[model samples]
Target: MSGHGEAQPMKSRKSGPLRGVAEVPGDKSISHRSLIFGAMAVGETRITGLLEGQDVLDTAKAMRAFGATVTRLGEGAWTVNGVGVGGFREPEDVIDCGNSGTGVRLIMGTMATAPITATFTGDASLRKRPMGRVTDPLALFGARAYGRQGGRLPMTVVGAANPVPVRYALPVASAQVKSAVLLAGLNAPGETVVIEKEPTRDHSERMLLGFGARLSVEKTGEGHVITLTGQPELRPQTVAVPRDPSSAAFPVCAALIVEGSDITVPGVSQNLTRNGLYLTLVEMGAEIDFLNPREEGGEPVADLRVRFSGEMKGIEVPPERAPSMIDEYPVLSVVAAFATGKTVMRGVKELRVKESDRIDAMARGLEACGVRIEEDEDTLIVHGMGPGGVPGGATCATHIDHRIAMSFLVCGLAAKAEIAVDDGSPIQTSFPVFLPLMNGLGASLTAG
Candidate 1:
């Protein structure tokens, strides 16, 4: 994906009313899971509304490498013919997940108990992320791994010849880590038990049930206990992926900050575990209408009507809410920059290990744009100067992370001067249509 040229720095300026309908791409999490679970099932799985981003596409290619038949039928429509449980063939080529930690980690777990070996690699940003969180739990199912000294990638995974299930209590609240262990449990001998003190996204658990696997969750005094029966015949499914709330955050935050703007984002996921940013926006005095709330393919969906407001005031985001909005803190910080007071976000040490240390990336970039920010290992505090008060003349280095690149671009759309990102090329890894969508909504974005 780094093939996207970096010579083209992206710039954005103060915008007019951002009016348009934005249909962001499919959920990256669901897109990767649908293809992965499909590849492990017994029959053909047809998927619609798939995110065609490089991250998910790299996952699709990995499925093919494991001897599954994957094909693209049309835009957002894909076919996956699975190899069934415990039937994976050893891949001849290495799997390059291309900047997707989710894709590489989850795929490693999917093949962990299948008596096969595969090596995984990714782009520069992803290579620096810690894979030990995933590889640690996977080893419990008898899988073995050898990578860089710090457990970084260009790694080799050897699947278990005979896996025995074990009960695990999550050390960190990460959907990727939780899902990796569960996927590895697929071919283990007995029931696999996972206990989480705090809840993360449950797409893997929900999809397992939908695909005819025996799974159950019970909330007890300790935590949420998830039990999965291993070695079941995984049935294929017709998956209709929901639009991503993460991608929708860009437009929704943009409309809130730009003066006199009113915009609607259609068919976005409203799952409680993923809507923390929207809820925080409402608390900050945003007038967003969740029109026509309904369910699509077993997930909550809604049309978001966002209107620009200059009266927004920042509020403290509690530690308990961090897991739900972890991926959103970068852009949420941008929204806070345009609000009227201080926005405090804590319990996000997890942000330190993302594609980049997001707190460091945003704090430095925001300071460069003449906005005040405070940060530590677990908290990010943005001191807002109100809408149109920010003097945005600085150019930000994206650190090759998509969220960092997009957050600064949104900052430029309301600041007194233009904001520039050193490289917008990484934006394609998630929301490929970001620029066109922003431009369509009346934002001033120039590609150099």
Candidate 2:
């Protein structure tokens, strides 16, 4: 019953060139994993740079309910005293993951093999999302999940006393489904194998290895095959989460499209598996440089310096790079509106099932702003405006999605006329400091 808060409606106006350095929050995927892994470890796990967003905070609370001692030391610092692997106690209350699909899905997998029953629910947006993608896989692990129609939330998961390990070939490219199976396999006997035809975010696999779980990744001719040895005694370690590249996309794209703008974003994760947007932008003739590239927390880190570019040419984004930059498509579409030629993005059927129909959202909003776009079942093509050619007197409908709201706001920065969005309140789910941070960087955003 934790998702009792009502949605608030808000709007945003046109802005100017976003300037100065921006320090985005820690990666959301890593933050959620740190808490879950820490809860399952034998000893204390220290975490630094954890995202303090509402979604992540809800996960922290859920961990505590499952008998783990989670404490917040200070800003971006947390500690979890774990209950040991395969040793979760039945929660006395329901688990509420708020608006985080990552949180609820992974937690379901973590608790699905422990011989306990737990009810899970979330906010309106999360409740509407299909949990069938995760529950269907968990069912193969001997867990019983019963939810509302279409496998939506407000569901109950009954863990199996003796779970069976499974070798699941993902039907689609979904990191959540992949991570769920891996987490459930940690308590089963024998090896749990997952074959992903298209590589998604490998945060769960990477973090599992970091936590001393017996996990390995091998690339097969067909796809990436990941095998995890079950029932290992996991050891806790200190974790430093990397800055989110998805959140960094807004400022980076804004600087590239806004005239007379130069900005630097430090400590951004440049994992080849997650930097597709930057690579695609470079191919579009953006003036961006990777400065002082180094490693941080076992991930590639770099300082991104972006300057205003007046001559951007659109390029066809390959399907192979979809997993690397799935969350960035909304912002990328915004950038494409200012580029010359057509930007074609294919093999993105996953967009239909995100927080909202991201393809329809971007296509509708961009069209209102005088940008031509077309969409099929799994493809989107944008006809660009060639350098400052956008006539952006429009109001976009956000449908309670944070990325949709933020992407349209960035479009307003370089537009000839002011732009507006129906709702900006959803920004708190991920980047709560977005408006103030961008305003500090000299962007003229006002709450209308």
Candidate 3:
């Protein structure tokens, strides 16, 4: 979370080829769902390979506040002894989720129908995020939310004493919002249904089924309709989380740009909903080999052998594919800067509401680094400069966004000069060991 410590300004410079294996941390999405669903189950749910990042850790803390027994046994091993459905206790103090939007939103939903009142707050970045998107849909289940103007954090949610099931459609394509509604429906009577025009990550749906909930998805003329039978006996699970593709993107993309670099990233999730960046890279003629494709934890997994590509040309990223790769766009733009043609990304207005306005942040940061860029409300076009073409002498403002900070650091690895970020501390929210992990792989990074 921002301001928890001093601002960590960091810088990176051109380096030699990055080698060796990069075993990135576990999936953040799955890590959050595992703890939430584990808290809703009736018995002890043991989890391995949980991402220990601050964001997921915040979720674990919230689960404990809601009367669940969350214990960390080892490096990434944890056990959550749930309180069962409708069994959450009113927390004695305010629930501070740090900088995690996922933690607060999903926890709100989990406690919404349990006759508990929880006050939620976060850091500077998290406080600015709009919570109404989640609180609005939660109201349909007979829950009441009172927050600051625009439905921000420092909010209180009063759980329904006599909750009822709801049938609602999403106003936007957000996995957080979708998962929040599904979690809220866990304690309501009868069936709670949610319809979405575009499918986001389905970790919550898959984990719900794994926890023995009656859930189904149907394709109709309107969209994808998801129905969940409320008040089921959630069973405990032994979950083994897959490696995060989003974290893998950093090392994988860094290898593609740095000359003569070849690296292996093991156990990355190849879930179709999260592989748009890899698909786009393949279209750009990247030399990536997906080796040993298999399934782990109900999701596809792969070991990627990434090699530097001397010949790469940017292509138009499909607008329909935005939901799958929303988090990867900032880094994808860095890759585009090293390509030979223009990379056009449309249907990305959602970037405006992230930790920062990512589109504007990335555009401004890249331009300062001597890369030409253009943007509108819903589109970002990067005019590529080919390999080693960017001058890269400016300091990019991270705006307390992890991806933006990491993206510019990646940009510096292949640029002519050095690149700097105003704040690198936010990277801990998702990838806590980013600097050490990259530095271990031969990156020239320093505390600025």
Candidate 4:
């Protein structure tokens, strides 16, 4: 099983103006997919700039457990020698995916039609997250899943001996669920179609095509129609991942509120599906420039130049945009605390099921920091005090969620007093270099 280990509590103090360029790790979404898709290809797939966080590394281990030969050539460089479709071998022991929902969920789909029975478990966080979302779609492919109450983790997936392709419409806007179904369809017969009323991240669709799978996506009145032909011979190719825009939210928001701060984030993924946070920030009066727009790995990539801007006014985030920036609301809430008026975010009930109840988590932490916040089942309203109006000096519990931890640390960058997170260890799961990267940019941080 994956280890949670001891909690490491850390504190952050109010910092001076932050300046410098930040190069965050590769996109976590793309990293997990790269390892999984690479493991599913016929020949060796070499990858550069893969995120080496625990979540992604666990995916790499899970790929190996399923019989792929994955090797780390050096830092951020790995190679996967795949065993194509329907070629996975059932593991002798349980597969522990640690804190990665993406790792375990996608891996479950990978094995759902391989005539294998694989038991999947994760850390406390992942085990608590509902697995029914992914399993329900896999069931259409003749996969059976038996797990704890409420279809949570410590679950076992019994693959279909004679799998058939399925056409599933996504019930929710979840990239994980969408990706899981597409992966299970790989070994199923015939074409698998998935229609999502709301578009989620298209990494799976993009990566599948890049790996030599025959797939097509079209937008109709209903939503996005994605069709994939199963059992194709996937060929390996080199992959270069772009920097994660999600992780860049921290520094970008910190610079926006720190007064006179300016920062640069280079080579970030500008894929429309994943750039919602940047769009939301811009809506909140952020001055961010998309520099040197170019294409890398078939996805749009750009450099972001952001500067301190205190004239930001709160704006209601259109609910439809939530799917694109779902992972960024926590930090976006921090930015809202510095803006004028209320920032209303709707269509975000998805925040409730993340690593933690993020809406509740951020609401409590922000209120403790003397910021006014109103939250219900599906919306979070953060009343901004504008710059220099936030009161700090609260010890916030991160709920073992990486976003909550990082969001609060960014809060301290502009708060009047020091802010502390109960544990900083969770940051390792996604952005292991977060601390040094922030400090190098002139933000003062001290470990506890």
Worst 10-residue lDDT window, candidate 1: 1-10
In order, candidate lDDTs are 0.92, 0.90, 0.92, 0.92
TM match of model 4 to true structure: 0.99
Steric clash pairs (candidate 3): none
Q: RMSD (Cα, Å) of candidate 2?
A: 1.5
| TM-score-better candidate, 1 vs 2 | 1
lDDT of 1 by residue, 169-266 (tens): 99999999899989998899789999999889889999999999999999998789999999999999999999999999999999999999999999
Off by over 4 Å in 4: none
Cα lDDT of model 2 by residue, 263-366, tens digit: 99998888987999999999999999999999887789999999999999999999899999999999999899999999999998888788788999999999
**Candidate 3 structure quality by residue, lDDT tens digits, 1-448:** 3344668999999999999899999999899999999999999999999999998998898899889999999999999999999999999988988878778888998999989899999888888999999999999998999999899889999999899999989999999999999999999989999999988988998899999999999999878899999999999999999989999999999999999898999988889888989999999999999999999878999999999997989899999899999999999999999999999999999998888899999999999988899999999999999998989998999887889999999999999999999999889888888988998989898876
Model 4: lDDT to the true structure: 0.92
- Residue 132, candidate 4: Cα error in Å is 0.6
- lDDT of model 2, residue 372: 93
Candidate 3 lDDT (Cα, whole model)? 0.92
Give all TM-scores, in the order shown.
0.99, 0.97, 0.98, 0.99
C-alpha displacement of 206 in model 2, angstroms?
1.3
